[model samples]
Target: MKLQGVHHVAYRCRDAKETVEFYQKHLDMDFQLAIAENEVPSTGEPDPYMHIFLDAGNGNVLAFFELPSQPQMGRDTNTPEWVQHIAFKLGSMEELLAAKERLVDAGIEVLGPTNHTIFKSIYFFDPNGHRIELAANTDEPGMLQELKRVGPEMLEEWSRTKKAPKTAAWIHGEGEFPGYQG
Candidate 1:
């Protein structure tokens, strides 16, 4: 079965109202709709929850659930903060920088304009302690094509040694990538 696209992605929240407000104020996401029920429709369990939906632009939806009856929310302690995050694409470098400024103005501590070869990004935390990243693309025309060209070789090397292959190291401009390391 071929999949079309994501209808929505849902995560747990501490408070539905606060989650909605945070996304609205910070990310400019419109509150689309909210679903409240005393029982889960899919599981048939008697657990009350408030499910909220936000517009993530271009027909994409981000959702959250606030389960008041459950224990307080906590993240996986084993996972590093950067490993699990929600990343959003901003229109341009200017827009990404502006967002970082605005977030700092709102008393949020943000990190980076970190360059990832093909994009530049900033990182911050939302009210729920979820790491959020906003990135702007900066790749040259054939950048993606170049990466795709090396995909097979990279995967083959990785499969054999379980180590990061150097095929795409040009992005990092190190080791044999034809660039100064400093």
Candidate 2:
């Protein structure tokens, strides 16, 4: 079956109001709607929560839920902090730089306009401790095609060894592989 597109991606938040305000002030996301219920619609269990949705440009939606009855929100102990992050694509490099400056000026510790060959990104954390990345594409011609060409081999090696395959090292700004420029 063919997939249409992502409806939304949801995550747990410490406070729904804080999350809404943060996204609105920092990322300029529009607070679309909020949902509150005493029971989960799908689970039929009695649990109170406040769910909120924010516009992430181009019809994309980012969502969060605050479950007051549950314990404090925390990330998976087994997962590395940097392993799971929400990445948003900015319109251009100018926009990306501007956003980085804005975040830094707001007293947020921003990481980088780190070059990834195909894109440049800056990373920061939200009030909820969620790592967020804003990226701008700067891929050269045929870069994605070259990466696509190695996809099969990369997956095969990764499946067998459960290790990162070097096939796409070019994308990470290792030795230049001709397709993408850093």
Candidate 3:
């Protein structure tokens, strides 16, 4: 079956109200809907939760679950915090930088407008300690095509060696692409 776009992505939150307020104030997300249930419909377990949905623009929805019955929440220690995050796309570099400034002004510590050749992004954490990223795409005219062309080879080599492949170093202008002069 072919899948359409995501209906929503759900995560645990400490407080439904606080989470909603945080997204609404900081990210300008609209509080779309909320569902409170005494028992999980799928499992029929005796648990109460507040499931909240927020509009994340362009028909995307971000959701959170506040489980009063569950123990205090924490993140996976085994995984690097930076490795697991929800990234959002900003319209442009100016917009991304403006967001970083606004967040900083609000006393939220943020990191980066880190460059990745094709994009630049900033990172921050939500009230739930979930890392969030706002990125603006900055791909040059033919950069994406070149990257896509070598993607398979890069992946195969990386799989075999478990090391970064040099096939796409030109993405960062480390060297020229073979047979093509800039």
Candidate 4:
């Protein structure tokens, strides 16, 4: 079952209007469309929702649903705040920096342009308390291919030890092993 690409990814939002406005103003995503339903189509239960979609560039669509009848929306308490987030890719380092500044100027606290050697990224939260990341790639020649080659080994090592594997440490400026350097 080969797939072309992601159609859309959906998340629960506190307010549909606020979410649409935030994405439109801050991230420059187009507010594509909205949907309202009084009953669940699949479940046949009466659960009203306001669904909205935003274009997240490169044919990717980000979506949200505001369910007013349900309890307040929240994230998983057990998971670390940074563990679950929606990451968006920016065109270049310049665009990433500009986005960071724009978020800060809008009174949102942002965290890094943290350099990971292969890429740099900044993080911030939206009005709904959803963490978001904007990243720009800066990979060196053969970097991605090398990482891909080591992916299986890294996953195996991780599964066995539940520890970070050293195979891709160079991407974080960590000490490198031979045959894995620029």
Candidate 5:
């Protein structure tokens, strides 16, 4: 079956009200709606929950569940904190920088303006300890096109070697390969 698009992305929050307020204040997400239930609709489990939805713009939605009956919220211990995060795109480099400044002024510790060759981003955590990234596109003309052209080859080489392929090393300002035009 063909999928339309993501309906919503849900994560666990410490508190529903706090989560709503945090997104509203920091990300400017509007509280769209909330769903409270005494039982799981799909599983029929006897659990109470508060599900909240926020407008993440462009027809996308960000949702959270306050599961009071569940155990204390914790992240995966085996995975690095930086590995799992929610990333939102900003319009430009200026917007990314401005967001970083605003988060810093609000007493939130932000990590970067980290350069990913094609984009720049900043990282910070929400009240629920969920890592959040705000990134802006910065790719030069033909940069993305060049990467797309080499993507399949890179993936195949990586699958066989389990090492990063050098096809895209030029993205890091490395010298271009023999046949690469970008």
Candidate 6:
């Protein structure tokens, strides 16, 4: 079967109302709809929940579920906090910097306009303690193509050695790879 695109991405939230308001105010996401059910539709279990959907621009949707019956929400203790985050893309670096300024003005502690070679991003936490990243593309022509070319080789090397391969070290401004013209 061929997949078209993502329908939506769902996560757990502490309070549905607070989540809705936060997304609306900070991120300018429109509250598209909400679903409330007293029982699981797939299963027969009686677990009431409030599911909220927000329009995340360009036909993308971000959703959250508030399950009051469950215990307090907690993150995975094993994974590093920076590893798991929801990233949204902006059109330009100016927009990214503006967003950081707006978030800082609102008294939110935001980290970075950090450069990732291909893009720049800023990080902040929502009221629910979910890390959010707003990034803007800054890739040069052929950069992605070069990375794609070396991806399989890098993966194979990583699988064997369990360490980062130097095939794409140029991404971090290291010495260029052989046969790289970009």
How close is each model in CA RMSD to the real structure? 3.5, 2.4, 2.1, 1.7, 1.8, 1.6
Over 4 Å off, model 6: 176-182
Instruction: Give one digit per residue, the lDDT tens place, for model 6 in 24-111.
Output: 9999999999999999899979999999999999999999999999999999999999998999999999999999999999999999
Best by the TM-score measure:
6
Report the C-alpha lDDT of model 2 over 26-101, residue by residue, as the tens digit. Answer: 9999999999999999999999999999999988999999999999988888999988999999989999999999
Q: Model 1 over residues 43-88: C-alpha lDDT tens digits? A: 9999999999999998899999999999999999999889999999
lDDT to native, each model: 0.89, 0.92, 0.93, 0.91, 0.92, 0.92
lDDT of model 1 at position 122 = 95
Ten-residue segment with the worst summed lDDT in candidate 2? 173-182
Candidate 2 to truth, TM: 0.94
**Clash pairs (backbone) in predicted model 5:** none
Task: Give Cα distance to truth, residue 52, candidate 5, Å.
Answer: 0.5
Q: Which ten residues in a row have the lowest lDDT in candidate 6?
A: 173-182
Candidate 3's displacement at residue 128, Å, is: 0.2
Question: What's the TM-score of every candidate structure?
Answer: 0.92, 0.94, 0.94, 0.95, 0.94, 0.96
Off by over 4 Å in 1: 175-182
Error of 5 at 151 (Å): 1.2
Deviation of model 3 at 102, angstroms: 0.5
Off by over 4 Å in 5: 176-182
Model 1 poorest 10 in a row by lDDT: 173-182
